[model samples]
Target: MDYVSALLPPVVMAAFFIALVVTIVKSQGGANKAKEDAAVDAALSRAESARQSQP
Candidate 1:
């Protein structure tokens, strides 16, 4: 069982890494972009309102 014990952590980590990569590869692009754009727009609008409120 020495060999199995020595290799088990690496094997489990490798499996988790592979699963993370697969999830990233299968993910969507459109909704994320839209979310980012909305966030930026909100920030910009808030800044514009702040500037208008200034003397």
Candidate 2:
């Protein structure tokens, strides 16, 4: 019972961590991929332009 109590927290944390990872993995590169890519590219372009304009 002592060992079970000690190990239970880690087991529960690991289970939730795995679930989080699985959710993130499943969300990648789906219908929103193009929109996300476009948004990132636009942000990068803006940053680059701003940097160039500074100096």
Candidate 3:
């Protein structure tokens, strides 16, 4: 059917999008939270130091 064919792609895309969102949400703030935080902090500090040294 033309209608079914037209709707099927959207339905499949929505399902995959939902699954991606769930995976991202579930991955936040767990065992890797501290490591991720530390990495960001280190990057920020490095940038600050570089900026200060420039001027």
**Over the stretch 1-55, how does candidate 3's per-residue lDDT look in tens digits?**
9999999999999999999999999989999899999999999999999999995
lDDT of 2 at 24: 92
* Model 1 clash number: 0
Worst 10 residues of 3 by lDDT: 46-55
Instruction: Give stretches of model 1 more than 4 Å off.
Output: 30-55
Worst 10 residues of 2 by lDDT: 24-33
User: Tens digits of per-residue lDDT for model 2 on 1-55?
Assistant: 9999999999999999999999999989999899999999999999999999995
Off by over 4 Å in 3: none
Cα lDDT for residue 11, model 2? 100
Prediction RMSDs, each to the true structure? 3.8, 0.9, 0.9
- TM-score of decoy 1: 0.55
Quote the positional error of residue 31 for candidate 1 in Å: 5.7
Candidate ranking under lDDT, highest first, comes to 3, 2, 1
TM-score of 3: 0.89
